[model samples]
Target chain A: MKILVDTLGADKGYEEIVKGALKALENHNNLYLTFIGNEEEIKKLVKNNTDKINYIDTNEYIKNDEEPALAIRRNKKSSLHLGLKALNEKEYDGLISCGSTGALLAGATLITKRLQNISRAALTIVFPTEKNPCVLLDAGANMDCPPELLVQFALMGSVYSKGVLNTNNPKVGLLSVGTEEGKGDKLRKDTYELLKNSDLNFQGNVEARDLLSGNSDVIITDGFSGNVLLKSTEGTAITIMGRLKKGILGSFKAKIGALLLKDVLKDVKNMLDYNEYGAAPLLGVKKAVFKAHGSSNARAIETGIDAMVKFVENDIINKIEKELAKKEIEE
Target chain B: MKILVDTLGADKGYEEIVKGALKALENHNNLYLTFIGNEEEIKKLVKNNTDKINYIDTNEYIKNDEEPALAIRRNKKSSLHLGLKALNEKEYDGLISCGSTGALLAGATLITKRLQNISRAALTIVFPTEKNPCVLLDAGANMDCPPELLVQFALMGSVYSKGVLNTNNPKVGLLSVGTEEGKGDKLRKDTYELLKNSDLNFQGNVEARDLLSGNSDVIITDGFSGNVLLKSTEGTAITIMGRLKKGILGSFKAKIGALLLKDVLKDVKNMLDYNEYGAAPLLGVKKAVFKAHGSSNARAIETGIDAMVKFVENDIINKIEKELAKKEIEE
Candidate 1:
């Protein structure tokens, strides 16, 4: 399978991106990667030997602060825009970028366009829960979503959960203030109705308190609520972990125990790490697109590539299209 | 010195509620309590109670699923409604209830009424952060709030942070998806502008990821967003602690280490415990009204009573009224 990698906009810069791409290829012999960035820098990083590596040259990159739509519209020569265009052109089976989330989503939507029968494509994050990793979307793709858009998010999330997470018949839920049917505002109530009538295994409304209990495999929400939930969870985890580390360091007893529990703590941290999950798929785009965290390191980028490989090999895009088509027919 | 305790709707029965009231009075000698609920039930628990404890007869209680407005209007005989009425009548300096959040807010607004120059009353929660506890509001009050309502939330949160948390001139922040200006949806953008112009120590937009980092002493957002953030944080904390416990129990090494570090873990748990913070105040009300957690225990109820005593003794309601009135006059 062939994948396009945009080597810009990540926190560690181009060196880490190049090393990550090389590491991905070293791990997967069948995996082919097209590196899109400055030609001279790529050549220098690879030491003028671009064996089994396809290079696409582009020095310009979109800034994180740039207006997403304007950046996509204007930065035709940028690596992200060019990589997305190439993915849309079917030159690569999938695309991976550690760029700004807004730029990536905007570029994927405007350039690659939405999949057939899908009104809005959602950005989904697969984060760890107690039982297993669950899919949460839309994680900041379309902020002001209507009931219909949320329905589409649920549908897309279900397809991704089944195809990628191997969760057969993923239970879908609408995030709300309460688990009751009529608990939330107008949009949530309307979306709850829509989800209830859908073909997926609908679990009605799921409150935030139940989010990490693996009550539902797929949790659908508007970009605003989803983003808030994701970040709040992230912040809470960081704070708790930091506090734990502080506690261990503060007392001699804790410090002694920490030595024996070092591996256990590492396991817990790894369980909660987003890096292991790799990239968040921007589902609903015509082509497969995955977004790695902006601060991704070499290891994270490698996992992102592995995730893309799975997406391409399993034909996730085709499966999503088929499921959406079936839903459309049923409707 | 007088406080109203609604002895109904808690997960525990009246025995626990009465015990909690006694515990509160035990902590503060000057505190006088008026227990409002079933007279026979409370009398049995407080059999021959001393002079500080006063009893009122009421058996009615609001259900969690009952409509807030309808419940407030029809259940005037309910403990929550009657307690709020007494608070409004100046019979009690403050009121506490471990009842449904919707019922408490509705009763407080309709019976106790809002303070002068306040259009909406916000529910504020104080939770642990890395540095210190921060105030977040409106946790679940006004679902769809205008920019002006958010400004009021900030003002009220600032007063609560000062009067309760003792953070003088508290730095208030508008919670958003991003910290950058003009990043979030229209509501957040507008709220940012309103907050920037306010006299309170406004600290601009704060992302959800920085929420538990104690970036701001008071974080203000619309009810929908604030509720999602609050619950998400709570859920994440619960999930992480559960995972840590599970890890400790699964491995012999971890179990031994956990034994050694038990005190540290308990300290960590205590730091994150919601019960330690007592009750969330329904700010903007004419009188101090606190909504204790619905699933509160005797100890939690005791803390809620302690919080009410502090609010009443510090004259927080009058202070909020004065600040709001001063702002109105200045405008």
Candidate 2:
């Protein structure tokens, strides 16, 4: 499960991340795809079946309008800093990068860092919601923090919904503007009294109009209100699907009722596809960086390398570093 | 343009608010409506047409899960405090309410107050988007503030995008978590250095995924990040149109292409209807309260009395007290 791919920072470059890493090496036969950047455009998009992909050659990329801390101090051999120096030499258990979300949070916090009692870190994004697909988090990874880093982003988004959305305990919420206990500000009434005296599953204050009534499975906030509630729900679901395709193709009997729901509107646009929940977890990184969405394509970078191979088979950063070292040895 | 309206805080009471004010006085005519409450249940739902419409009894009726500041002090003869005491007796020209958005912001700040150099008051909404319909403001109103009340909520959201979405000058922004000029907190870096030396039209910051793009026609924030970017864009457009209606009714050639796009999925559920832009406009009140969505129905209380007869025949509270007294004499 060795994943490192940046393959020239997204918007589908280098032949759709070398044909989505040869369709995830035909479903992970000991996966190894490294391909960072321009080694003859990823050797003609991984041609001549290049022994299950590899090539960190690099050629500066991070340009989604530069200045992410001055392009990680003027491009230290860029390709998103050589894919955050191969996940800071864990060689690659995880680290994908569709690219330039401010140069993957300034080259993954200057090549892997922030872990012990993580003060600021976040990029969550879950979204399949109707019940489970809620987790929003630092959708804007720290612009300014401390409400005890949103109570450690609600215990790192309920330790990624009880270790990778399996969710048995989860429940937490603090995306504010009232659920009371003297509602919001002073950093959400001091992170709602440190997440209602910490333990987790704290569901108290959540109202941004009842976040799609599947309510709390870890919503958290700050990274500037989870990057404006993950870009105002990705620009109001692309302006309510661009006014539902101009109000159903602006009449002709709503374009023959949108051509009889055009193949069930492309399977309801692949279940409100944010590339069907691909990659976002930047969390309090030690290994998994994730990022994707520099206009991710090829099925959102094969759903960001199957969400970095389900965070390297759900080690989930050593269970969020043993739940922040057992909440720092019980404070 | 009279207005008043509580008709005993709706839950389909006062017979669907007198059948949505006799279907908005049969398409408005410089109307007058009033209707406070229990005048024998709004004269048995406007029977024998009591000369068009107007009532005022009010033996009270608040409940809708009470606690909106103790249901406006245990219902002072309710009807949301006699329809905000007839918009503080200027003989109404504004005052709607479907009921309890914390009892209409604690009865419009303890009965129609803050409009002189308006210190606190917000609730805006108007979203709609796909390039038109923008305005979001403190959509839940004050859940803790200061960055000079979000730089007087970006000059009352640039005088509500030039007086109710007419946008002559608009472009205000500042929702933050990037679009830099010192990315957020400390109230978005002190409201982006007083909206980069004010005189409005700032446009410096805007991320909650570009709040339903049209980019900015007044965005602002803080009402706990504008109620978590208005309830995570109403829970990601009802969780991406309920997984695009169960992946377009999962089955049989997508059920014959979703019955030929049933009028383009009701034009994508009326372009993601947030009650098709009904209430919300309590902006630094002195009149015109608005609110609406308390399960509104009756065509969202006749589009919240046509947004209070276009904010009472468009003199929007003397043009927001002369452009907030000309931005407090140009600060």
Candidate 3:
């Protein structure tokens, strides 16, 4: 499989992105990468030139402050726009970027276009759970969503879980304030009614507290609440872990204790750190694309590349298109 | 001061409730308590014939499954209903109940009535931060709120932080997906405009990740999102702490390390425990009312009573009424 890698917008600079792409290439001999950025900078960092590696020059890039929809329309020569345009042209099987989320979503929808019969694209994250990682979608794609849009998110999320996460008969749950028949606000109640009658394995309303407990394989909500849930959980974990560290280092006995429990601490850290998943896929787009973290290091970028390759190999985008088309036909 | 206590709805039974009330009575010399529940059960538990502890007979109680509005209208003899009715009649300074949240909210709103100029009653929680406790409002009251209602929440939350939490010129922030001026859904954007034009100390949009950072003294949002945020943080904390404990006990080295850091762990646990604060106040109501956790023990119950006493002494309800009236006058 071939992938287009946008080597800009990351906090670690071009060196880390290049190194990560090279490392990923070393592991997957059948995979090919086309780097999108400054050609000279890419040449200076990458020592070896092989048929597997390619480069596309684009000095311009979209900034986080610019309006997403307008920037994608205006910045034709920018790396983000150009990289997505290349993928749209079928130059590569997938695309990955650590750029402005707004710009990426706009480019993915407006430039590359959304999948057939899909109303809107959703940004999905695989949150780690006690059993396995669950797919949570519309992470921040559409801030305000109607009931129909949320129904689409549930269908899309289920497809991603089955295709990428390798889950069979993935259970889809609507995120709400309660687990009863008629709970949550108007949007949720309406969405619940729609989902209950759908073909997916619809588990009734799942409370936010149960979102992280592995109650369902796919949890769907609007972008605003989903984003808040994602960020709140992350912030709480960071704060608590920080407190735990400070507590351990506050005394002499605790300091010694910490040294002895280093392995266990590492294990817990790995369980909480979301970067282990590499990137969050922006699903419902016409092609396979991912948004890596802004502060992604070499390892995280390489992990993202591996995931993108798998997304292409698994034919997730096409699978989503087929499922959505089937629904359209039934409708 | 006089306080009305509902002796039903707790998971632990009448004996625990009686013990908790007695414990609270021991702490306050000039305080009187009116217990509302089964007359026989109360007589069996309370051996004291003191005039300070009084009882009212009520055979019925609201269940969690009953519709809130219907239950409040129908279940007149319920402990919750009778307690609220007693408080509404000016028989007590304040009220405390660990009953169905829906029933409590309905009883408080319908029987006690809302404070003048207040749009709706809000459930307020004081979340402990590194610096101090920050007040979060509309926790689960109104699932869907208009922009004007959110502005009221900000006003009420600020009053709560000032009167109860003792913060002067408290910073009120609108919770949203981003910190930008025009971020979040239509509700947040419109609320931002209303807050900016209002007299309150309005801080622009605050991300959910910053909710626990003590960045703002009061965080305001619609009940649906607020409930999700509250529950998500709680679930994440519980999951992480559980992982930490499991990891520690899984190995001998870590077990010894944990033994040495027992004091530190205790400190961290205390910092994260919501029970330390005892109860969350149901603000915007005419009376000082609180809803304790259903699983609350004797210590938690006592703490709730102490808080009720403070609420009456500070005249928080009256203070909120005055502030809200002043805002209306200015408008």
Candidate 4:
């Protein structure tokens, strides 16, 4: 499976990316990588392993100093631009970037363009809810979206939940402030009305608190709000867990007890960490594209690659097509 | 302080509402409560308690069973609407409602109307950040909003932070998917540009994970986004803590150790449980208003009343006007 990796964005330098690429190659030798970055950095990272990793000399890497969109506009040779351009030209089955996700997303839409009939692609994340992992879409993909766009997000997320999560009939929900029918704004109100008759599992409305309660499988909202909610949930969970670590294990005996229950603590930590799920799929793109978290470590990158490889091999595009066709029939 | 309480809504019905009202009245004898609901349901709880609690029968009690907006529209006697109407008529310093928040916000905007200078009213909640309490605005007040509306939210949030949180110069931040410039979509881009020139201690955009770490004193976003973030944060905190109580301290050794660390737990819980600070204040209204969680028990109810009492006694309205006028001069 062919996958393009932007080696400049992660906290680790090109060395780690090269090492990760080599490691990914060890498992899947047929795995082709198009590394978009400077030659020297890529060589330094790749060492003597040039056979597995292919380099694309972009000359310029959009620095954190520059503005994201403006950088994209001016720096055509930037790795972000080149990587997405290669993906746009169908050079790879999927594109993977750990760099400025916003830049990646921007470059993806403007370069490769969204899929047919898709208003805009959504970044869908699988959050670990109490019951199971639930799908949250448009977690800041396109901030200003129309009601029609949200409806599209619902359909796309619904298709994703069924295809990925293996839910036979995923209950699609409109994420609003409250669960009532007419709880949200004009956009939400319209989306809810559309979802009600649109033939998806249309679970009326879902509040943010209800996210972890497994009340619904597919929760759709605009990117801005979804992103905020997703991040806030992560922050709150981390803060609570941090407090538990500090507050409970502060004392000598408590600390000793915590050590005794270290296995339990590990289990608890695993439950909270979202990196286990790999990268978020940028659904509705022409080809499968995945975005790793900015703070993602090597393991997350590996998981993302594994997920992409599996997705590419699984022929999920056919599934997406079938789902869209089903949606058409319902409409 | 004269405060209006919607003596209706809650799964517990009018009995708990009135019972909580009586406790609220008993707790603060100087505080006057305009309890609007079915007179008899309130009477059953009010009994001979006539000193501060005055029952106002609006012939409307909003139900949770049906659509919220329609419920508010159909039930003219809904305590939620009537209570807001009283505030609109300049009958109280601030109104507190224990009804559906979506309905209260709708009623607040549609019935009470915003202050003359204010274009939109936001629901603001305070969270205990690393430093002082962090104020988050438009906590699900409206789902769809323009960039200018978010700019307005920042201004209003800054005013509230100064008045309520007692920050001399509260740093206002535009909530985004990331902290980088042009990191988000159209709304964020426009809002970021607008915030750069606005009359605020405008820090750059703040990411969700950094929200609780005190990246900014006041975080402003559209209601739909804010609401989801707030609820998710709250739910994550509660769910994780509950799991800790049951899972972490489930064993006998930990249980024995946990009692010794009760003070630590209490302190940590206090930090996590932001409601202890006050009920969420509805900013930008002509008259100050507060909305508490519908499931709020007695202490939370008192906290709501206490916030309103402080809002009234502190001359928060005049303070907001003075701040805005001063902001105008500075800008």
List candidate 1 stretches off by more than 4 Å: A26-30, A38-51, A323-331, B38-49, B329-331
lDDT of 4 at A139: 84
Q: For residues B65-162, what per-residue lDDT tens digits would candidate 4 score against the true structure?
A: 66666776777767876677777665577787778776887788888877666777788888788678888987777667888778777877777787
Worst 10 residues of 1 chain B by lDDT: B41-50
TM-score, per-candidate, Cα-based: 0.94, 0.36, 0.96, 0.85
- Steric collisions counted per model: 0, 10, 0, 6
- Colliding residue pairs in candidate 4: A140-A223, B59-B77, B60-B77, B60-B78, B61-B78, B140-B227
lDDT of 2 at B23: 83
In DockQ, how does model 4 score against the reference complex?
0.50
lDDT value, candidate 1, whole model: 0.85
Tens-digit lDDT string for candidate 3 (B9-104): 888876677778778898988899888888787877776636788888886788888898899889888898889888977667888888889999
Q: What is the lDDT of residue A70 in candidate 3?
A: 95
lDDT of each: 0.85, 0.74, 0.86, 0.76
If you assessed candidate 3 against the hidden native complex, which CAPRI class would it receive?
medium
Q: Which stretches in model 4 have alpha-carbon errors above 4 Å?
A: A18-23, A26-60, A68-91, A110-114, A321-331, B11-60, B66-92, B106-114, B146-152, B181-185, B191-195, B253-263, B321-331
Candidate 2 local Cα displacement, residue B157, angstroms: 13
TM-score, candidate 2, is 0.36
Error of 4 at A100 (Å): 2.0
Error of 1 at A170 (Å): 1.5
Which pairs clash inside model 2? A208-B231, A228-B208, A231-B208, A231-B209, A232-B208, A257-B261, A260-B260, A260-B261, A261-B260, A261-B261
For model 1 the local lDDT of residue A70 reads 92
Give per-residue CA lDDT, model 1, range B1-331, as digits (tens): 8888888988877777788878888899788889898877777676444788887798889988898789988987888888888886746788888887898888888888888888889999987887778999989888878898898888888888898778978999888888888877778889898888889899888999999788799998888878899899898888788878888888899888988888888888987888888889899988888888877878888888888888877888888888888888988
